[model samples]
Target: MAEGFLRPSNGRMEDEGNKYFNDLLANSFFQYVKRNECEIVTSCKMHDLALQVSKSEALNLEEGSAVDGASHIRHLNLVSRGDDEAALTAVDAKKLRTVFSMVDVLNGPWKFKSLRTLKLRRSDITELPDSICKLRHLRYLDVSDTAIRALPESITKLYHLETLRFTDCKSLEKLPQKVRNLVSLRHLHFDDPKLVPAEVRLLTRLQTLLIFAVGPDHMVEELGCLKELRGALKICKLEQVRDREEAEKAELSGKTMNRLFASLAHKQGTVLSMIFWRVVCAIRQKW
Candidate 1:
């Protein structure tokens, strides 16, 4: 997806992408697939037999070492394998594009103006420099399982960003307010659905939103506006909904998803018994 290899010209990109992926899996190109409760593949590993054929395409660098030659290098994988610190010493970065890092980048900033993908999953990093706006071509960023608490507001400047995943970052508070400015955004995966920005409905191209929490500032209809949404979605704070008319506006019945979960456990007198009953019936009728 980061390379636009599965991008489709029509319909939802994820739908077409998943079809191609299943084809590859059925053909024995992928192995050890892991699926979620919704039966969606979450992770997978390539067969070692297939790895040998593509070994030359991937270069393995030693820990705490300086880069020697970097004329045609585009991808760098520094996912921590041990306690050694990964150093970016003597590296001549000119046009590097991708970086998968799990260790603290030391020795230098290792900033490459042409960098495209940056995955810092399971790292000790805390914050991103506001200077990240310089990566105009950046398309993918995954900071899952990290200590990062906040993202620089300048990240909204990357108009080309399509995927921004920060899942499992327990300390993170919320997404940038100007996130809607990322016109090309297609996916926003986070751990806390309540932390999602209120203006996220503006991202019309969005396809995957696993959870949503209705609040005073957000309406239930916001999820309905995202026509491309798919996969599993859990809607929390269903008691916040006012009436059946409002719930009808959510159009949950027409949503093309695998499973739907609604939680009204916190219901209070705030929702009248008669109104709430009609509202539940309205939504269920659609489903």
Candidate 2:
């Protein structure tokens, strides 16, 4: 996704770029590929041979030690046990393009001005700096399995952001309120069922949302806006649905999905039947 950032962004490069990534993996360039329940590659470990081939360009900074080419480093891997940022003051941040941190705690000012991809999965970080809005060139961000509670509102201003992930963030309950501002988002991989923000339906280009929790504020009908949704989708709070009319507005008949799960009302009623009908229609069109 980071390499897909091109001039005159028409948004087709990401799909093309993903193909290259898949091919490289098939050719044994990468290993330990991690995927979510919906089969999205959340992370990967570069093969040792491949790492040696790109060693000059990438730097695996352990504990921010003074490396030989710290000034020219573009890709950095924080392999320290977690905390301590004392030795990193000399490393320039303007030229950094990617950062993968295994640190348990991330400190210091968020100053990666030119960073493109950031992966902090399983980190102990609790919050993001408001200064993260400075990453204008960022295209991919993953904070899966972290302890962060919320994303700073400044994140919504990243119009060029293509992929934003918070999968398995048990403490992070919801996405930023103005998520509609991410006009270029393609995939939103998360674990929370109720992470839907206001005007999420506006993201018609979105292709991945494995869990859809229907809250009173955001009804089931909003699913109609995501015509491209595929794979598995679990709908919680189906009882809040008003009636068959509201459920019908979801337009799930044409959606090609492998699985669609919903919690219908416990008691038999019109709402229960309505929920059941929608689920059946969705299943019939499974991909």
Candidate 3:
């Protein structure tokens, strides 16, 4: 278990001084415990447990000493109040297996050769680097409650990914067409009220889908193609169904997708802002 607080030395700064920093430290300690044999975990011992702070202050003063080689560390989490440029620069993501949470990903060439999973919850992140497509081993990603607008076509390269949650990505318009290539995906959550994209039916392995809509009818034809979704599909609008036969067929067979709510309408711009926010809130509560 992570300690509630880390007491600082020199009677200097209290953990209360920076809540985000303290939280990161506590989480890092727990991570170290999970991966005890890793060398970087050993180095976390140098700083006084109570007085210990972030590694950015401890090992970043020198250049060649760290940020490279056998002493190199991975699985980092620096979700402070602002952009964590220090953490971004210090660790090599290509060798990383996990990252707790980060804000912006709009810096330098993000070349994560072997990265498997990344989480950026409750951060200020607005856009993803097109370079994100380079991670051949990536399997999981979460970018909830951020300002991101859309995913790049390059995202199709993550063929191995299984879960992707873009909940509360309010500004997102549509998913990239290449999304269909993620044949391995099992769960997906995107809060866009736009028509469910036609590309989704291609992900034959998908089981759980949380979707918002511009009008469910917009992609009704494509929805019929998803024969593999055996779990549930929580959609924003049920009124989009123009074909009663399709709905009835699936329901009668007892194999139809589960609907969270039965109806929705298509109206964009600020005039529909109230409805949009209401549906978004409902999705969050359900999730």
Per-model TM-score versus the true fold: 0.85, 0.81, 0.59
Model 1 lDDT per residue over 1-287, tens place: 66667767786666788898888889788988999877778899777776676443343456644545534556667645543233344334545567777765522456677677877889778988787788888889888999888988899999989888888988998777898898888777886865777587888888778778888767888977887777777777777788888988877677777787777655567436567677767766745
Candidate 3, position 52, lDDT = 54
Off by over 4 Å in 1: 60-71, 81-93, 265-277
* The best candidate in terms of TM-score: 1
**lDDT digits (tens) for residues 1-287 of candidate 2:** 57554443554554667777789999989888999765668789998899898876687767636665467777877777533354244456677788888663235654778888888888768898777787899989989898999999999988888888898888887778899899888788886767877888998877767677677678788889988766677777776766566766777767756667776545667756766666545434433
Question: Model 3, 1-287: lDDT tens per residue?
Answer: 01213345543122244455446567653333222221112223323553355443223222223333422655565545443554556566566666656556535555566577777777777777777777767777888788788878888788878778887877887778777788778667665656255567677677656563425334544544555554345555544443444344223133333344434555556635554455334333423
Q: Measured by C-alpha RMSD in angstroms, how accurate is candidate 1?
A: 3.1
Model 3 misplaced regions, further than 4 Å: 1-72, 88-92, 212-221, 230-232, 249-253, 256-259, 264-287
- Model 2 misses residue 29 by how many Å? 2.6
| Angstrom error at residue 64, model 1 | 7.7
* Candidate 2 Cα errors over 4 Å, as ranges: 5-14, 31-39, 42-45, 63-66, 82-87, 104-110, 242-245, 265-279, 282-287
Greater-lDDT candidate between 1 and 3: 1
Clashes of 2: 0
- What lDDT score is found at residue 131 in candidate 3? 77
Angstrom error of the Cα, residue 265, model 2: value is 6.9
Candidate 2 similarity to native, TM-score:
0.81
Candidate 1 collision pairs: none
List the lowest-lDDT window of 10 residues for candidate 1: 83-92
